[model samples]
Target chain A: MAASVRTIAVIGFDALQLYSITELIRRENDYVILDTLDEQCDIDSIDAFIITPSEFVSRFDLFLTKRTKTLILADKVSSVGMDMSVSVVAINSRLSEIEEAISVLLNSAECGAISNSELSARERDVLKEIASGKIIKEVADTLNISVNTVLTHRKNISAKLGIRSVSGLSVYALMNGIIK
Target chain B: MTLFNINSKLCDIIFYDSSVISVINRFGINLGVGDYTVAEICRSHNLDENFLIVIINTFLNEKYFPERLLKTYSITKIVNYLEKTNSYYEQFQLPNIERHFNLLIMKSNADDGNLHLLKRFFDEMKNELLFRINFDRQEWFPQLLQLGNTTLDEDIELDNIPESAHPIEDKLNDLKSFFIIHLKGKYDVNLCQAVVSSIIALEKDLKQNNRIRERILLPFERALTE
Candidate 1:
């Protein structure tokens, strides 16, 4: 039997962006967009919530319900540049990236496990460098390795951590204390 | 972390001076966890609020404090750890830059960074907090009334006491002093009437930043003596 189609809700301060993302999502899957948090919302029916940056922090406590999945989009997590706990789909994200994020969320929910334990020390070191706000080439130079080495380490790090996306890696590194 | 750990960490990464270390150490001890409020610190140390203002101004000087850690520590676990330290404000150390961070909002605007420095100074008041005062006042009032020489009466008068109009330390201290003075008094009708008005003002000012006000001020008021 085919898996049931899932519905995702896009919520944010930007109506145009919300509509666009919802349109893109609706084209590929069963989904809906909420213009605002209102009495009309069926809180029990939403499978996931994609919250924009400004809305994320203010409504974090309210929308972070146990039954619903959440994704946050922001420039930086905190003033100190510390990491945040939720996944972030960047504002200018590509379609493939968004689809991958949705798939990862579904897979993680289905598998009941998300691992960040398979990374090697070198791969972790590279991740730490990346976490400290360094670019891949810069990280490569600091580690006294080639640019290709750094990219390879990053790819390996993501796979081992059970996160196949850059945004996923960023959130993972932040929440896990692997990066500040 | 204490000035010592902060100093040691910087010394490990960059070179600094003993004079700066001494200054930071003294400042750390001054900020040590004691029964301190702005009034108490000013009275016991025989220092004017201007002196604290000067210290804060001096802290804004780039040569006096490093700008990097100042910004980073504000929104991180560093401030949390620093509060727990037995010696936080005794001495001063510089990491590298000249800047300050606003602890309350965790923002580091570059212009006159006085707001940021004052925010950290206010964070010092967190040490003595005992309980929060809110709609649940009836439940907590009995516990506190029992702990001190206070009477839990609904008719209590708070006329002479100044109401805290803001979440700033000065206002919080004023509110604390008022709470202390009214602890054992019988509710005076005339005074009770004014208190109701002040409570409304206090509630309005507190609504904007309830979490911070609750975490810092309410507990500190509870810890104050009658």
Candidate 2:
């Protein structure tokens, strides 16, 4: 499997606002802008969404409850229902503030306390190897398993943990002492 | 002049053009005291007076650096002074040149594909320099400083590039050739000239570092280990 870079989508931004925001985030190497709300977007792969209050209507279900982190503008924060986990920034926040919000949201998930009682011993071995920077073929070679088995184990791990990126998994391993 | 053989109080080095500061700044000797002359500043800092004269003349004429004269002064001292000049150049000049060069290539009638590739090459070169200098400041310089203060005393200066595991001369030549091969008729004349000046400045820095590594650091480290 390829390394995962988190995808962020900006919703409800006018053309001028979209350009400036995209320009700011463009400097960061870790992020990839999936698309603006102007066209059909890949909602399934989106790791996070940046939406204004008026535009939150387009992805109301996402705003309410989704495993993915959502960044809501300040003006729209008041209208959001209780019992939701979302980061809020000022209506006219600077680039630094947006960066802070994104970092906090990305790190907020407690992957350090991952529960893997369901994973088989072989799956656990594959997880540890991949998290330690081994590719699928290397993991298979190291464990004396077929490459197909390694791919199956990776898919199962992503499905179970809902964590996709290599960086994210690397952090999880470090935090949980799965890797040094 | 042995600090007193000539009249120093009324020298004309600083009185002509305000831009003369570019020449005078090479000494890293400042006029901190309101009533001091260039002689007094140089004497206090232990700088070579003859070398200062040559540097100032070169700066005034907009000529390339006098590479042969580098051997006459304390190489570490010259490296320290040139490193400061490099800082000032990066802060005040690099961005302006990059922006102007980019705008020129964008508006030119040259082959857009090759021009764009050249632009990317230029950007990569600039980024490599900026990142390398930053790493030196953040990691290598600090480590050297700690070693200097702890044991070497007057023997080690922060700008002293140590006897590295690699050759410094090859790196210097590589930097020079990168500029020569890329910066030419393809670029606007002013842009080419500005980039050449930048390359020369970078060369002076590496050359001084190489001198220090060979002259002072290698012997000093060998003695310490022995």
Candidate 3:
């Protein structure tokens, strides 16, 4: 099977460095480099965002939201202060290392996208109440939330946990010590 | 997705999607089906070729539910096929999954509590499935068989036969997701892969079985009673 082409955005590089990086990436058959990161650029469509360290620092929150798919281009001295959660590739590293970093980011992003099992605080509250044998109305009353909100949380919980049955949720709660 | 017809080579169909081997097995068709067309196999087995084709096509492609075609077949035939599928599950699929799961846990670290939770989840799922199978064998199938011939018992609630807030197939999917996402620590990758593949196969089988039951069998029974 042919490898799926990965869409990438090269951000925060000077004209000379950006040209060199884009040329190197273009030589490979499996990558499509976006022209520019402008307002019209669909951020989510890019599978991997290759950004310079200065740009990452300036827009830390934006990159943090997509940390799994973000690859930071940084020198060794500047990389020490970078968040360990995000992958870092040296600015002057060999082409192979940069390619490998992007590949790793894309792979991890795929796996991460497969399952988002973590429950939010409100979701945890709802789960605990529901798993304790409370019906939807009762859960809403306990949480001081509307019935529709409770239902929405229930749906989100099921989607995240990959479980829809109250009994299954109860078992998960008991096993995970979310509820006694 | 190829729509397999009566004249289609059974071997070619099998080669196209090997997973259909289990579907064929449920029909009492065994392997070494050398160079035989579907029609030829159906002739040898005294099977309905159209029914077999419908089942195979539905199994191969999720969107290919020929409801009109399915309703033409006798309920007895559909029920018998479903019973055979249930037997396949009880006799093979469930045990096979548990065996792989047991091996997976054994190969992992002894102190891992998450594995124990997963086993608990599996046990619950297994119980639910067995309960469903028993319900089918003891109550639902008999009622379905007696639909047009004899009146159903007044006390027997037909709607409750296959009812569950959480379907057994979804639990299998949950187990699969756990393996793929939440499972952490050192363990046997080969054994883990075996368990995941087995779960996925069973999940697919169950979903297909459900489509037949929900779309074909139940609606046919309802129409007959009406």
What's candidate 3's DockQ score?
0.24
- Over B132-202, each residue of candidate 3 has an lDDT whose tens digit, in order, gives 99999999999898875332233433454454344687788778877886676787899989999889988
* Per-residue alpha-carbon lDDT of candidate 2 for residues A119-143, written as tens digits (9 for 90 to 100): 4455567789998899888987897
**What lDDT does the true structure give each of the candidates?**
0.42, 0.53, 0.76
Task: For each candidate in turn, give its C-alpha RMSD to the true structure in angstroms.
Answer: 24.0, 25.3, 14.3
- Model 1: per-residue lDDT, tens digit, B100-121? 2222123323343333332333
**Residues A117-163, model 3: lDDT tens digits:** 46756678989999999999999788765454466567657767777
> What 10-residue stretch in candidate 1 chain B is worst by lDDT?
B90-99
Give each candidate's fraction of reference contacts reproduced.
0.00, 0.00, 0.32
Clashing pairs in 3: none
Q: Pick the candidate with the highest lDDT.
A: 3
| Ten contiguous residues with the weakest lDDT in model 3 chain A | A76-85
Q: How close is candidate 1 to the true structure, as a TM-score?
A: 0.26
